[model samples]
Target: MILQNKERIVIIGFGPVAASLVEGLLPAVTAGTIELIVVSSEKHLAYNRVLLAELAVGATRAEHLGMVDETRLRNAGVVLQLGRTVKRVDRSRRQVLLEDADPLSYDRLVFATGARPTIPALNGLNFDPHSEAQLPHGVLALRTLEDAMNLNKVLQGNGRVLVLGGGVLGIEAALAMAEAGHRPVLIHHGPAPLGRVVDADGGTLLIRSLRAAGVEVISEARATGIQKDETGFTGLVTQTHGIIEGAALVLSTGVRARTELASSCGLAVNRGIKTNEYLAADIEHRIFAIGDCAEVAGQAPVGLLAPGWAQAGWLAQYMLSTPAPGPADPSLHDPISLAPPSLESSDVLMLKGQGLELTAGGDIAAGLWDESGSQVTVFADPAEGKYLKMVSQAGVLTGFLAMGLPRTSAELVLSYERGSMLPADRSTLLRLDDPGILEPAGAPGPDDQLCRCSGATHGQVAHAVEAGCTTVAEVGESCRAGTGCGGCRAVIEAMLKTPVPA
Candidate 1:
């Protein structure tokens, strides 16, 4: 049913969100109702940015990072303009000006430019976002495949890798580097790594785990300037640690939404490209934004893939359902109005690595001395590299942070999501890590969330496995589990080995 008048959709940026969007819209694409054009500045096709750390450590290959099949996309009549940049947008003409290329007209324009690494402003480092300023030699950010390749080169040598920032990526990078037989020195200004997500007690256990994994932890140390010579980057000069020698510096500081194109085109720009609940940029023409670049309802993108994937799927369906405005009637906005589901915040944080396992969710900052009605329980054994804190409100698990206990963390996450009441005795929950201890009722049910990122439940994964999905990757392809963050991979594997009872 190829229509003569096909709605032209131009999507800029081909990341995970864009990949998901294309997958969702494949049916419509095959039906020939709409024509799709994907443009990206990166030369490579869409790949999983979540596994950059694993790639850097040589644990995963570049081919494994691909999110979409280019051949399939091309076969579906998708016009992919790779390694191309959209320099300008003409709202009146409904055309996007490209760099060294002809202007591309579109019936609907989607901004999926995602985000860029937040290069820290340090002495001896001049990174101008507006200009093409290169980072100093021996310094990098593990955000892309190119960065991973460069970082891998540095890790191959016998010098200490200075990892600045103690966020999830930073920790993963440091641990991966250490696992790959490289020296890594983790420097953070806070009392411990993951300070924003985990409390002090949990942080202490994390620091211990890092040390056990051969990563040197330098806490409360703020890096002020870069230490470099004619050869290359020597190390970093910290306010507390003074001069810390290293072969390369990996900045996992943060990320900022790439909103330059949106801002230049008179679109509302806050921390990201501003959009309404329907992912519309409030323009008369069909202009929408999603992924890490879209800031909807004053909520900025947190650099998480789950929310972006959700937006991508929703936007794809929305575009398909709504009728496009007539060519002559430019001012007539489509009457279709269905608000997208609210994006969930990163309440659940899990750090999975060798010699380290932690999961924290909700507000676990409530102290034991608090006179509040919430019951706070703390279990700490520094010698054993274990810690657990649960904040229960009226017997329901409100908040929790666990370390060195994978089983307990999994159970806690299940309970947290369910809002289920904790056992009368807290020790019973702690004993989950004990050998040969069967789950005392209230275990992971069929409906329990197995993959938080994909919203895939235990039963969903079980069904996928029963349908002949043998491996984790197969299950992921079937049910979209273990695709984001890779935190729930272990559980998915466990389920595959031991069938979940109906």
Candidate 2:
């Protein structure tokens, strides 16, 4: 007897987070255990938003940005609905109200609402939040493919551009525009560029790197208003300084969790939709939230894509391992733990940008430093535009900054993620292009997670290799590593190059 009928699963949003969710549900979906309905507000097919910068500068085309192909969805029997907004979520009826269609009922609801770009509330900048507009010509935000398409038009001209905000997104935008042969000036509110991740000294090095790439980094300035004309956004006006003229303005101000839909339905709300470690919404155990829009209270949201993928895996396990309830099931009175048994401990950030390599996370901040217990070491070479910071706690590695150090950036990311103890002579770890000395240096440890995007471990990849997978593509096909974000492609290639010890 069927313990429970196939679950009617409805997933809202189709970004990386939602894609990860689909990856997790693929097994069940293919097994005829669940009916998947993915509803996204984006009109286009699911695509990787991380590479929008490349699309803007003419490096990559639109066809390459897509994340999901229709053939795969059709084979898996997934109902992929795009360009539709969920106006209302009725928790009582377990239904979602769409703007141009009928209600989508679900036995389980996944709120992967993701985030929306922050359209700065500057004077003369008018954006109606209720409706999605084509973003009048000239004004741009590097958040979506449509914005990137419009930006491509702006990049075709040899005109100067003004970029607001100095975070990772802003930096990438400025660099891309500069590479496109346009003069790009970056205005950051902080004392230096990339203030949040890098300290004053590290940020100084970042500015130099940006400058070397033809980007003008303006520090300690704030944009009070924006100037507009009949054409659209014209330029930016600073607080004290005079107007900064530009042919167009690109706002990479950052993003906020989209919580209106969940909040309107009487779900618990915090900085994002409140979900437990298992990603189950507090409103109902069956209702789950993930990605940039969901966070556990007292813990900062893992705005990056890795945590969302991890949560998707955890939810998949929760669904598979738990016994399905039969008729007269007491599931309503008793709920199950949906969070992963043990999520990855250390925070990891390996930002993606061509020519500019920077990986900072896992207690890399100065505030996490304590003279009595931690060692903060730094080295910078202006000639090579490289900066490295290794924060060690009680004789073990904690966090680091590997900016412009191309060779060891991926190594440092993996080491930090693994929480492996630093070797006695860790100065070698700071040395560029040298593994120097590691407690276990030859190959990735069996327990180490090699790809954060796919949560594939070293052992898994090695097993695939042992099974005659000689190429990165073969390994990705064998174990599904390097399939998300494409940041780990280099790491996978490095693994292929390293010989197995006899």
Candidate 3:
């Protein structure tokens, strides 16, 4: 892989992956080795799609959603082409056709066009441009910041808000609407809320949380059609029940990869644009795909910020390492792959290698266990929505489960990962006063997930810290640990404060 004097790189879709790739390639860009061109179908540059619900509720402004400033990209010598959709990609000629502009030839082309919301094809669900049925007036889908802004305008006054799907997005949207003083009703075809990710017990806990937030959750209910009156959407017709009246309907069903452009251009497509481990399409070596649009080796796409960020960095490094470099190492590691998706029921258990141990089932109930597998103590209060179970052997805390509070759980997991002996009194186990509870002197376990958002383990953090990351901010900036929810900040901060063995 040798680059000529004027090698051009064109990246399609200015979402997280593309934005991250551009940012990661800044050093090479400054050196004048590469000319980068970013093409986005959206009028705006890269923005954070993860917080669309927050934007919908007017909690954040549209400008705040953008990931990077245009001036920064311009400073890095990257060309920005916005509001122009790619018409087609001619692989044989290595060119990309834009909607209004001339064809652009590229030495390397990247397809990072993200996924789109899957609006179910129901009867009479057409968008009426002339009437109030159009978005910013009535029904809307929360995907982009523009969509959120449009929805916010229509939801000024109080009205019935029907939320379709009980997934994370749907739940978040429903909660946002309810919090905004609108009556929100959630309808899901699944048996329980967040059924795909959490078990029935966890789902029950989540449902209780939603209901406490004034959200009406109706599980095992499917929407068959949209009921619209002379004014606009009046209600939604269910498969089993009769019509449920509502002022507006929001669809959070799910999304599919936006592969119309790729498929039309004769690129191979399975569920998404099929790519190898290096995120390169099997057909064309010069072309690479990332983000939600690219499926690696038939694995279900993670479709999160962490994986996309990793993909971008690795892809940029692979592309830049040419000429003087030997064969580029195509092997890429995504820390997010280790962390469980929030929707999955995978239990983040803390196990004691010895006799005493505590296990918290998905129900948030903690159960104490002994070496003989005998249940010693069970602490659960479904009514109060609290569960704390602990297991011990030989008068020492072996295992524990503190559900609903992941920060607390993570602290306990870290304690267990370090194999620290618990205090004699079981009540003191929850207290963080003891310094010995921290990961054993300098031995940070590899399996312990340090960055909860990206599922980066303790070993990964230690490795990054050893590689010149002296501060938590540096570690976060370099590896993206405390970037998302900031839940792992305490643990990362504690590690940074603790002195390593001499």
Candidate 4:
């Protein structure tokens, strides 16, 4: 892992995790130890994939989603190859053949190849994706910024949209289309749209919220096929509900890890490229992988951004020196292997769109708690669009979910993550209006985070305020607390109101 002067370190993808790795590797490159080459198959520079739905909804333009500054990247002596897809990887020769350009050589290759959208074998989407597949006239998958731009173009025609799949992206896309004055029908096979994320109560209330925001949700309807008439693609043909007519279709099915190039080069790949604790694939020691595409066997590939970011941080640090103690080459013969990629973790999902404000995570239903013999607490007020459910085992808050209560959701997420003990009177936890009744036993420790989006802790935000950050905007400029999704602005303002410790 020792990087010699001018070491050619070629990263395959330019997604968020790879950008993070490059950001970490930037400081070390001052001595010219590594020659960095980032090859992106995408035509445009790397943008925030998570906020592309917002782009489609016209909340923000495409220019706002940029992850890295091109001028700064150029100043760091980094080479960016846009619109270049790797046609093949020659492992023995240490070179990558490009489709549009000549081959490029690398001393050590890193695969940050991210995931691609999973289109079901439905009548509309099933086809060979590699051989210039043509989807139905107006059907598209909201995978990249380019896709978002195409969706916006469709929106301009004031076309009625038939959004397939009931995942997060599907909901957001439908809501965006609805906001742009198009009536979009949301069809889901499950009884509740987000049954996996929310409980029965939360799901009901979510339906209410969506309806109030002018979104039409059709539950328990499985689409059998996409019908096309003489005009073109008509709409969705469901088994039970019959045809739901619309002008266009957008599919938001989940994604699979993009591991085609890795598999082509004789590397072991299951759902993702197999790796060990250090994230070195079973191939060469210098050859490594990270992000959504890399999987430590026995563990499913983490499709979320946080775990991939953690993996990149570790892999970037691990690749700076000599290899870890073990056989540099883990055998590819064993496909179902296990690597301790990270610590035990949980993800907080925020329903992101123009008007949908909901956050859910962990075991979030009474039925789930009953199976584990854990105590369950519940609070439901559908009229006000609030639902709170908590799961406790041996006096520790194990899992919890709060909807329509931003403050409670943020605090509950912290409590679950820190494994905090619940108060003796558990019922008071849902008292959102009376902050005194629901307050924790003590103030957060200095290391405790006040804003997860910006990685600002109590100490950091407090110090920034103490250094004369008088307003939320000023604080955001100083520490980036309220700048992201604006979900943590309330917490930041409250922190600013208190006597911040040095």
Candidate 5:
């Protein structure tokens, strides 16, 4: 679809995806090629929902989490309509009807309405007083930043907090509440905490960590109902056990894709709005879905912020450019695969090229293994909760995983990928610290995979430089490297200025 000058684009949901799209369209918006309108049910502008746990712990203020600056958005020609919900979409007329406003027509409609927290049905349970509608004052579910702030206010006074579910959000909330000096009791029907994302061992480790942090965890206990008293919440009824007392409850059970608008408009709805590889919904040609609302390849929404950011970038590129032949390549879009958090404990050994050259050795668990039979070693302590694992075989480093250490892993991985020989001993490897390690070596070639997250090879980046791709953004556009975690960005820039060896 060719976007004409003065074409109107209306976006629903003023969350991360929508904000990102608007920020990306700044050039087009400034040039008067597109007119944009963002409709949000929230009263506040788009904010970072990923940091809600931090908000709960009081680490970050509520206003600081906003994804976009309102002034910047306004200056870029985006019309902000907050505190309004889209009642219905009349696709035939190409207009969206808001709850209290006249129908607004659009040249293109983008569904970034996002997902809401899924509050399960329980008997005799009333919504919390701070809830949006006051269905009951006994149950509280957090999805929005406002929800987190309200829950934080309610949790201020001394009271028992029974957090339901043991997923990432639940664990995060439980940890945050515990850190805030609130005694939180976690209930999960699953076998362990973070059961969906992490493996059994990793979950066990996480549960142990939470318990050490003073959280009472109950697994295999499903919340069946809630009992309330005149003062507030009274008790929680579980399937396996009888009722347990509680002053307040925070439900972190899970979330479903917010598809009310899509379903109401008669779009193909499964657990989420089904989208092709390009993130475009199967029903609407012009409309697309991204972030938590779109389901790709039957995978349940991971709800992590990074994947959503990647999806939004890809969608923006596709929307702005001509239609490419065939289905959109999944390889082009790097959705982080849902792997269990690594919990290995073994001694890490590294070999760069030939001879038993020792780079950095550490203790790692046996579980974290590569395709080869060699076990990953971790030099860092698991008890202190700082771990590093690096894998190498036949005088070459294959893979490395480090939780807290940043440049160590990046340097080691770069050395391995470039087939550079490691320092003779552990002391030498450890002594060669940060800024020095990033310096280009005379022997090693520049075309090494410095960042494994994006599979960015130095050669492809060098080629971009030869092709007049002078800036990092230009290189990213040309080769799609250094775009994921961006940890190697500084290294890439450093390499650009260095001269090649004869």
Candidate 6:
């Protein structure tokens, strides 16, 4: 299919980044400057994958996970081909061949194919590379909605739910299952879960909290094979130990970027589709990539959602400036430059569930005996499942990890993000965990991030409120302050209840 006059832009993959890009380009599409066609292999609309585990445990609904306005997209004259797979890219004719559909030609093509779950090789489990192979009956990866549904069904069964991997997803899955009254055993090959981010002592505290929450953690164990009986799956055979019995298995072993299409079409493929700072896969051919599929030069695809969203927004603006794929339209206001957006910033990871509060960010590898002259403070209470470590350089908070201390962690996160100097009495920070101790009456500054998930700030929320948004839900709809993870909902509520700073 071809169109005359209008620039036809075809985007493959409809994940969060793709959805954001489509949202960003709707104005141009409505202006008749561009026509957007999105092809997605999944049947459902773009949804929040971060809440998949909660959905699996029946804690959240599918409607709550939606990330896009489908009605708005359809009304904007965007063509959405859901549950369809692209067969190949015929670059010579600038057309994409789809299975069971006519070839769709494009002036520009974007590959947002996203990433796939990494399935570990084990006995009794087989995966096909050429096709989208389904895992065996009792085994699944907690990556997609289908996998979450399967996991929910597996959780309804009697036997133990074995979770393999020690990443954030694996830990969250295990904890969720345990809370839902299912027997969950988390097996990891490392000394403990989150070894990369958490030190050995911090890992010990995390293990204690998991155990207290009724999750059986098996550390330093590698699953070598899968044991099966007349039933689908019986257990996982390990190298260090014998067979660890379980009814179903969840593989939370991370993800690999989808680069099959880019590689087949002659795009430089490394960890992902190699692109320059401008997110162009092949600028000469007008082919570009973003999200998990695009490996920007000198940097691998980050697993975080913030960077991907930033890239989508940046690329969308860039595309809007250059509607016909040549030099940027000089008449366009604020035409995007060839320079890439700055994405270098500290990443904060917060895990709160099952009576556990853990917050970690930035370089927390500082030790007690460090001669680097960085001020490092350590506090530990293993019996109570509490540990706190703060690393500061030149009195500025650099990195910190707080488990079982929510209030202190909150202060640490604010200080770290703001690059503020720590107070003279560091012991006073520990008093924040007390319920009676109230925070000073003042809201975060305009630039301070109120919602880490969406990266919404106090100024943005205030603007939304001033624009007549009275409630938390209205603020979320207006500025996306509480839309992601719902971690910032309380703060948004508090801000709405009181007058924000000017």
- Best prediction by TM-score: 1
Model 2 lDDT-worst window of ten: 323-332
Tell me the tens digit of each residue's lDDT in model 1 across 386-405. 89999999999989999888
Better of 2 and 5 by TM-score: 2
Residue-level lDDT tens digits of model 3 in 122-200: 6666433212223323566787776777667657656777888876668767876777766789988887866644445
Instruction: Score residue 115 of candidate 4 by CA lDDT.
Output: 84
The whole-model C-alpha lDDT of candidate 6 against the native structure comes to 0.83
Arranged by TM-score with the best first, the candidates are 1, 6, 2, 4, 3, 5
TM-score of candidate 4 versus the correct structure, residues matched by position? 0.85
Please give, for residues 1-502, the per-residue lDDT of candidate 5 as tens digits.
3244566778888887677777776777777777888898889887766567668667778876665678977887888889997888986666889989878877667788677666666777533321233435646776677667766766776678788887656766777777777788888888886553334444555566578777898888867788877766788887787887877677886777877787777776677777666565643455667677777555545565445656666666655553221223322343323332121112232211111112233222335544657544445544654344455555455544443334454466556555565554523443334355753333335655544433456787877777777677677667655653344577678766766444
Error of 5 at 193 (Å): 1.0
lDDT, model 3: 0.66
Q: How do all models score by TM-score?
A: 0.94, 0.86, 0.74, 0.85, 0.67, 0.93
Better by lDDT, candidate 5 or 1 = 1
Candidate order, lDDT descending: 1, 6, 2, 4, 3, 5
What are the per-model numbers of colliding residue pairs? 0, 2, 14, 0, 22, 0
Residue ranges of candidate 4 with Cα displaced over 4 Å: 1-5, 127-134, 179-181, 229-232, 322-344, 352-356, 365-372, 435-444, 449-486, 489-502
Candidate 6 Cα errors over 4 Å, as ranges: 127-133, 326-339, 440-443, 499-502
| Positional deviation of residue 279's Cα in model 6 after best superposition, in angstroms | 1.1
- Cα lDDT of model 4 by residue, 1-502, tens digit: 3234456778999987888788777765655776788998887777777677678768799888877778888788888998898998987677889988878877668899888777766776664543323667767787788778777776777777778888877887777677767677787888777769877777888777777777788899888788887756778888889998877778777778888888899888888887766677754465788878887644667676556766766666755654322334443333323344463345667774545677776765556436777888888877777788878887787767677766676667667768888777877566644556566445577777666554566787788889988888888667656655565677778877887565
**Whole-model Cα lDDT per candidate?**
0.85, 0.75, 0.66, 0.73, 0.63, 0.83
Stretches > 4 Å off in candidate 3: 1-4, 126-137, 229-231, 323-379, 387-408, 411-448, 452-478, 485-502
